[model samples]
Target: MKGYYQGFLIRDWQECDRNNAANILHSVLTEYGLPWLPTGADKDVIKVEEFYLATGGEFWVVEKQGKVVGTAAYYPVKRGEKAVEIRKMYLLPEARGQGLGKYLLTELEKTIENKGFREIWIETASVLKEAVKLYESSGYQAASGVETPRCDRIYVKYLPLE
Candidate 1:
């Protein structure tokens, strides 16, 4: 389902959105001194819907007048797992501070929660203090054990009980 929030539009990713989504992902990551593209990055960009759709997952983009300004995605951390990991939750500088990050995350969390995911996991570099703040502000707790050297921090949020 596509949605409009403030002046931006949020929609399920389309094949045509590959470059726009990739550019946003590349620019945001590198701005924090992180690499532009991770291994197999193109698979997510080029086959976004294909990669996530069959697995009870989703990838979305926020666009302003047809240009991607932000992106967020969720995929199963592993087969038959109750936990889902968030990825690419980045917004351009122009789109920051307007509650867009929270908006994207809130939407994803709700969708995943409804899908019976017990918890959501997020990984981020310690250098991105603002991102850590945002995730913590949204009820994520610092989880022990780094999932990878690529990101030094991991956060987890258990879904609410029924």
Candidate 2:
């Protein structure tokens, strides 16, 4: 499944390929009232590099016709354990409703499983109804509830590693 769609490539992030992905994330998050306009510190390209090189975290970009359409990242949550967190999953408006979210998530699960991760967690705002639906549709049961200083609702999921 290297290139599932025409000109679509889901592969590791590269340093030079930052602004587009970051812009997509910023745009998506802005819809939820979460402003993350990338400053110098939040350079998507550099963030990807650091996360991959320093923490062994995995970053994936979905490109179609040589243009980025979606992005997702996975990072270790507990040291010496098979727990990880899925973060920054976003897709462009034009790319929604085509089962891309589910596809990206399924790919992420496969990656995590291969990395020995048994459980995956995600956090999202309650107001984002689409995200909530996506999580629930993907078999992510609510493990716990959380209220953060900057966030309203948080949900977690545990995947069986059979």
Candidate 3:
């Protein structure tokens, strides 16, 4: 959960990284004209430990030059048998178009599969075109029942059982 990817350190979230991670999520949402919805869609960003770590999930922060620039997390969900939902995957504007997003996602999938999760779900808005493309190209199939209020598309990738 801790390594360097293209000069950015990807590691597990810590108590000290709360504000920086939240700001990265908020900034990315705002850049895409999306609502923050702290009480709804983003409630977990403020309580990563309770919602993710405590629930047998993981939350990670990407740091460059000692500053948090991106966030990625996932939590076990009841949507499907042995499933998890990828959440809070966002990056600051300056951090986009650098292959970091794809790298983070690949790492996430590897970790999730290694942890015995068979299905990985993602819910995202169409406004985030880059994200939609990334998911589509990465073998995620379109699905329904997006639970997030701000999300309009849902995708699911089934990993081969080990």
User: Best by lDDT, which number?
Assistant: 3
Please, what are the lDDT tens digits per residue for candidate 2 over residues 55-128? 87878788888788888888887623577778778888877888878888888888888887877877777777
Q: Each candidate's TM vs. the true structure? A: 0.89, 0.83, 0.98
TM for candidate 2 is: 0.83
The list of candidate 3 runs beyond 4 A from truth reads none
Residue-level lDDT tens digits of model 1 in 55-123: 778888898887789988998876224989887788999899888888888889989899889889898
Backbone clash pairs for candidate 2 read none
Model 2 ranges off by over 4 Å: 37-46, 79-81, 145-150
Local distance difference test, each candidate: 0.82, 0.72, 0.92
Error of 1 at 28 (Å): 0.8
lDDT of 3 by residue, 1-162 (tens): 568888999999999998888888888899889999888889899999899999999999998898899999999999998999999999987788999999999999999999999999999999999999999999999999988888999999999976
| Best of the two (1, 2) by TM-score | 1
| Model 1 pairs in collision | none
Return the TM-score for candidate 3, rounded to 2 decimals: 0.98
TM-score comparison, 1 vs 3, better candidate: 3
In order of lDDT, best first, we have 3, 1, 2
